[model samples]
Target: MANFHVYAAGTGSDVQHPTIRRIGVSDVLDALRLGFEDFWDKPSHYVFLGLIYPIVGVVLITWTSGGNALQLIYPLMTGFALLGPIAAIGLYEISRRRELNLDTSWWHALEVRNSPAMPAIVVVGIMLMALFVVWIVTAHTLYARVYDDAVPLSIGAFVSDVLTTQRGWTLIILGNLIGLLFALIALSTTVVAFPLLLDRDIGAYAAIETSARAIMANPVPMLFWGLIVAVALLIGSLPLLVGLAIVLPVLGHATWHLYRKVIEPAPAPVPVKAARSRKRSN
Candidate 1:
């Protein structure tokens, strides 16, 4: 077996991005199918990782259940998707290893720490984290504006107000529009970035540029893919967020497959000659 630490380290040159391909709707569906297969084949391997989503969801919801912060619950749930690429890093690693017929043990996911692109990955992750934070703050501000700093005494009351009031409708419209912008930014930048990094040593800029290029090349398909993700996340969130344990793993695995479909194979490495030994001076 390949060393865990070296798994998913891209063999391509750090300066060059792999060629990008134009993928179609069929390709996206196939990627999801393959991703689901990966998840099904070794469901137990991902149980630990899958559970993290709902656990974090519950924690965030609980944390926001107090004070005026309760208004943040919806934003927090939606904002969770913004941080998904980072959260799914391990799933990417698992899928990569499975593609190579390597051991797909859950622990191997941690091997991402030793990847050649770890630094670049960290940079992108930090970018996503910043976006999430910005989204939370924006959502909170918007809620405060709609309600004039009034606190919802209970979840039921919040739901009723949001469903019945004009201000609530305004919040929904504006929030969805702003959230769409954020989602587009995340999708365009990260659709292939984390996977590309895991597969290659290319720097953050190149991986991100390649992802943007992929989006540009296949705008319709990319938009459809984004919609699919949004819908799946919404459904997964309905059951007290517990369904995310299954939904997230499937999406995470599929994202890796999507990257495979969008980016062409890395170019073959050029052979290098060994240096000649110098004879000792007489």
Candidate 2:
């Protein structure tokens, strides 16, 4: 197992090697612009490729008749679970590699969705599912307890009823607090970890720790990035969840680039020589 370490910004640590570039808002925006340019450079290709999963996700969530929370959960998780970063990973790698004038095929990025990286992807998928479960259970549990007499129907009714009750308010506040904490922890690493694993062929633990170190070193920028993602997600939740079709893919590709920016790839190790050579005589 590879040893991983986290460091504060300006810590002068080996992991915080000079090769890793710290980024800011402008850097992120520039990357997005470049990604968009790459996407549009071959508009029909990306549109055809990108639209499949997101469209299905939007349709399922929009038409599902259930609690809004549950409705959102089923489709989003389904899309993520099936695709599991396979769709946009190639686009992301291509975009990054293009910057270096390296020619790459879309299949090259898709290839990361193979054996070794699969477990890391699964871990992330499970974490997302756990978060979703917490959200649904808490939201519905509070709704049930608070609105038993009223029998709230719509999402708006459930939210209104919950806000009006002490216990409900407590649950909402606590849930948000807990969610924020998890979000912070996740944001600190998820941006770089997955791509690092794919790009470096490193194990999940090393990738995660390296990602965490990158975030710790650049806390302010990472916080801003997290805020941007959160706001984008909230906005995407609007338009009856249709906006997610655009937002999710854009962010997914952008995150792959972000990982490339922060986590310096470890150098290939030199092999050790044998102490002595044996000779055979006949």
Give Cα-based local distance difference scores for all models: 0.88, 0.57
Tens digit of lDDT per residue, candidate 1, span 170-192? 99999999999999999999999
Clashing pairs in 1: 10-199, 10-200
Point to the candidate with the largest lDDT.
1
Q: Which lDDT value does model 1 have at 55?
A: 96
For 1-282, candidate 2 gives per-residue lDDT tens digits of: 122322211223333232456777776776566556666555554555566655766655555445445423422432233233444565666666666777654554565566355565556545655755565555455445544534446766556655687865765676566557656756665567666655654455555567677787778777777777777766765675556556655766677766666666567654443222222221
Q: Can you tell me which runs of candidate 1 are displaced by over 4 Å?
A: 1-15, 273-282
TM-score of each model, in listed order: 0.91, 0.67
lDDT of 1: 0.88
Q: What C-alpha lDDT does candidate 2 achieve relative to the native structure?
A: 0.57
lDDT, model 2, position 29: 73
